[model samples]
Target chain A: MRYPVAPPTLADVAERAGVSRQTVSNAINNPDLLRADTLARVQEAIEELGYSPNRAARNLRTRSSHLIGLKFQPAQEGTANAAMDRFVHSLVETAGGAGYHILLFAVGEDEDHLRGYDDLLRATAVDAFIVTDTYLGNPQAAWLRQRRAPFVSFGRPWDDDAADHPWVDVDGAAGVDLATTHLLDRGHQRIAWIGWHKDSRIGEDRRSGWTRAMHGRNLSTTGLASRTEDTVSSGHDAAAVLLDEAQPSAFVCASDTLAMGVLHTLRDRGLTPGHDVSVIGFDDSQVAQVINPGLTSVRQPLEEVAVEIVRALEGLLSTPAVVSPGVLLTPTLAVRETG
Target chain B: MRYPVAPPTLADVAERAGVSRQTVSNAINNPDLLRADTLARVQEAIEELGYSPNRAARNLRTRSSHLIGLKFQPAQEGTANAAMDRFVHSLVETAGGAGYHILLFAVGEDEDHLRGYDDLLRATAVDAFIVTDTYLGNPQAAWLRQRRAPFVSFGRPWDDDAADHPWVDVDGAAGVDLATTHLLDRGHQRIAWIGWHKDSRIGEDRRSGWTRAMHGRNLSTTGLASRTEDTVSSGHDAAAVLLDEAQPSAFVCASDTLAMGVLHTLRDRGLTPGHDVSVIGFDDSQVAQVINPGLTSVRQPLEEVAVEIVRALEGLLSTPAVVSPGVLLTPTLAVRETG
Candidate 1:
């Protein structure tokens, strides 16, 4: 009838079960290696005494922390990228279901970021890391490999020749290809491409998708290619420039921000979006749906991607030595009102 | 010069310094208590041998993880609450500055959630927790207090009498007042209210601010109130219903999502937002600026609140058994094109 106020310890459970401390630990962590009868006795004792294994001690016993590291970036002011939200949400849900948690830490700029990673590694803070937004000569990739740390990036290694790491990236070229193909199927001859002017693997991959789609069929994309920054204002200016230079019937935008910008330009000229000039956007953001004319966009299978990333990371954690190849998931086109 | 492939250890440092292992440890972790000569000898040995303290060993010695836990919930599909984004961003930035890292975990449902919290606590996975979006009988508050766990909520304790925990909440009422006063100053006599239909401390607090402001000036809010779910569709529906029946000249929405919804309805009816009716929203999200006509909103001082929350929690962590009181922060008005 009387219950203990203090938390039940492993020693208490071991005493109740008449087993050694090592046996108790094995029952909790490596039950398969023990005899069925011994396992049953330890389990019964643990339940009867309401004993929960201490984390620090459990960590020492198993040499594992079921914790992954994620670099949490605060969104820049006045920016809303739903793709980032989707990826993190799906990744968290997937990882959590697998009994893993993410430790979020601020990654300092440049060399400081590598130092942060080193400290986390030295502190035994995480079992592995999920690096996003990777670029050429990314120090994280180099550091993780140098330390032989278990990790699976959510983006491709920019320098493929130099870097060898497990990763998962939604095929940007495939996503834009879907958008361009869909617009072409809608009987649009001149399909323009609107994207950022930056030099990025992702940006280049998306532009190439459009170029390949056009060149493959000889659809005459001349005077229809325009570039701008990732801002709505930039998209608007790019739209204006492209419109002045060429007469394109449709456009494939790199981001929802740019898509919304194109819509802004159309509205300013008192022109109907779909009827005057069809538009397809990448990243099926919530803004794509809320704008005056719904945006037909390419929806990255983020949930599937999350599941894949976790599965890959789990493989690394479980085996530790296997260098799994990279994963690439293709996005699907979401046909809404715009196109 | 040859370097050892294995990392330098405490034994190596102690052997090189010709001092006791405990003296070497004190040099790395706690140098104040050691004699200056002993500390200097150990430091020189460490520098010479390139010794780095092992994290697992350090953890066992200090019994602190320097890890904070945060529950990351993905916004429901089609829902975008930038307040969530702002709060996490500022909180992480502030905590990181203080040498604390956040462990982002997915909260399970009901009993599972409590179990997750308990597991994290037992595992020493996090030093403390920052509980947000608290409600009456929030199991986290109850469970943490019952176990004497260290945690500080980002929302006020809902059950005022029973739950006395350290918390910090933005004055929702004050936010509404800022929005209402701004509208009133724009020569609007009939200022309507749009908010959630649910019974929540936050919802009630926001509505009461408007009521107090109107009542203080002997102005009637009669036929000027509408409520809906915190979504754009609901906001649009509620706006339609209110505009049809209330005939108010201006509206104060509980959230930017709702304000955006109202704008959608107004545009549909061929009504210019500011000309026909002024509108104000809360949270001052990026949506406020991106909309056709910018929205004037009451912005929660999230960065300040983040600092305050961390400051209060840091105080509790540094000195145990001292119950720290809750903190409250004010909101400011951001004027734009809407009002």
Candidate 2:
């Protein structure tokens, strides 16, 4: 990929602008240090010759990469979750304005959970990390904390009350509650909840919203909830059992994937959704938006979450390195045709 | 993000192992240089102390960040294309084995197209770029070529006949042909096509496959094709028009988003998709797999594409930097309930 012609350098810009190399550097880095006229001349030379200062040299001088490492794992197969993509897009866009780029590395399931972080830390490849897998039992946040690594979590430290690391997370319980309240307002008395297994704190948090909403209305919650793995087939079978035995008037799912399974069951039974039985899903994923008749869902304020994460990162990287308090943003309901 | 405690360093590891710092460095960089027992001792000490070599210092010495920059643009709103996410996942996993990480920078629609590339290039932030937006008339490829920057495109140079660059692209034409022929085998002679505007070379390439398949089977192409934007609503509206006027037995769409629109139309009209009229979409997106009575579509060899791209990058970054020829992998039909 090498080209015979070398890239234009700081010296070339200096010579073209009739300024010293330091003056050219100042024009690029600290334009306020140069007079407007001289800066304009240097800028013109830069534009004409397309000169870019060497980042390697800059890293040696500043000891910072302005890169944030994110360990990316593919969504589990057979699930209808695309929430990570949306969050990542928002992160990249939000971080770009702050002059930060995301460095993505992949770790296989069998690989050590902290291997990616360890390698990046060893190599100093990124200034800090944005740990996303903060599920109840995930060890990344604790590992990063123990290493004294500068970082922020996209999830609250579910199991670690002592963890004071900066974090920004969406309020799952609030979002699910909003979804459940929407169903209640629609006159659905028997509402069933479908959620992940007992191990997932996030899932339990979401499930609480349904139980709270039901209990708040003096309604019975027995036999109206099911806990299972997060998969479409699992949701389908669970919904089938709930519909047959519990005879719930509506269903609230932990994810859009589960909601899709409920919809599939409705279709199989020749029952019309919204008209026959209402359904709401979490994540407001693409499937919810595009599915036939449209699915009402809880939409995470992912863009706002991205903004807050960047704000926390800026505070973390500041001169005094202020450790900001954790933030939990509320999610809104996307009321589509289903609910 | 500053911690009260300091991170474990090489010197700490050396002290813990009772070895000189040089021996520790050798163990980390070139383990063969140390005796077997001595290497094991240094490794143990490093593991116990969680010592990671400074990547910033090593980068200054090596002049390479080992990062591949990828300019990311969010999918067009309301499109059923999650192809980017899948490709990114594959690229991250594939590149990890090669000791490379992906650096993602977001470029907004209003920003200068090459601004992200220019900034990263000036900073020397990555070793090379992996350009994905190679649709005809896009300027990124040409701009990178003029700057003498090293890059491998995920698309072939559709507009430039004289251009030579390492690229790995899935054959959209063949994928569509396979889908069309599958419909033909199912006894559908009047197969209509839903595609993007004429300006998109990739869309046109896909359209050609349907036309070629029809022509090869001695079928008429007249009044059975429609060109519109790559949106669900557009596809829905186009399918309505084509179904009413042309009365085709089946439909072939350029993207899953478009295919979804056709399905929406089918549902609205109470027409069973496969039983009444067959449909096939491209990209075999998540929407295709999970939707009721799954939508059969074309699935790209994205994982293979990533592997081939890494191979090209290895060639490009070698000592003498060999420029490998472009690669075009054939896609397969993911047959499901739709067709």
Model 2: residues >4 Å from true position, as ranges?
A1-49, B1-48
What range of 10 consecutive residues in model 2 chain B has the weakest lDDT sum? B1-10
lDDT of 1 at A29: 85
Model 1's interface RMSD: 6.3
Tens-digit lDDT track for model 2 on A1-339? 454223567898999999999999899789999999999999999988777777777776776788888988665545678888888889999999998999999988798878888888866677888999888788888788787778899999999998878899998988888998888988889999999999999999999988888899999999999999888888899999999999998999999999999999999999899999999999887778777899999999989988988888887777768788999999999998888
- In candidate 2, list every pair of residues with a backbone clash: A55-B123, A123-B55
Q: How well is each residue in B1-339 modelled by candidate 2, as lDDT tens digits?
A: 455333577888999999999999999889999999999999999888777766767776776788899987665545678888889999999999998999999888798989899888877778889999898789988888787778999999999887767899999999999999999998999999999999999999999999999999999999999999888899999999999999998999999999999999998899999999999999988788888899999999999999999999888877777788899999999999989
Candidate 1 docking classification: acceptable
lDDT of 1 by residue, B1-339 (tens): 111112356898899999999988789879998999989999999877545665555555556677788887765555446666667778877897898887777765554667667777766666688888697667788777666567889888877655556788899998898778877777787898999876766888899999988887789998899877988899889989898998888889998878878888888888888889888888887667565667888899999988988886676577343446777889999888788
lDDT of 2 at B56: 68
Q: TM-scores for chain A, candidates in order?
A: 0.85, 0.90
Give lDDT per model, in order: 0.77, 0.88
Instruction: After the best TM-score superposition of candidate 2, give how far the Cα of residue B303 lies from its true spot, in angstroms.
Output: 0.3
Give per-model TM-scores. Answer: 0.86, 0.92
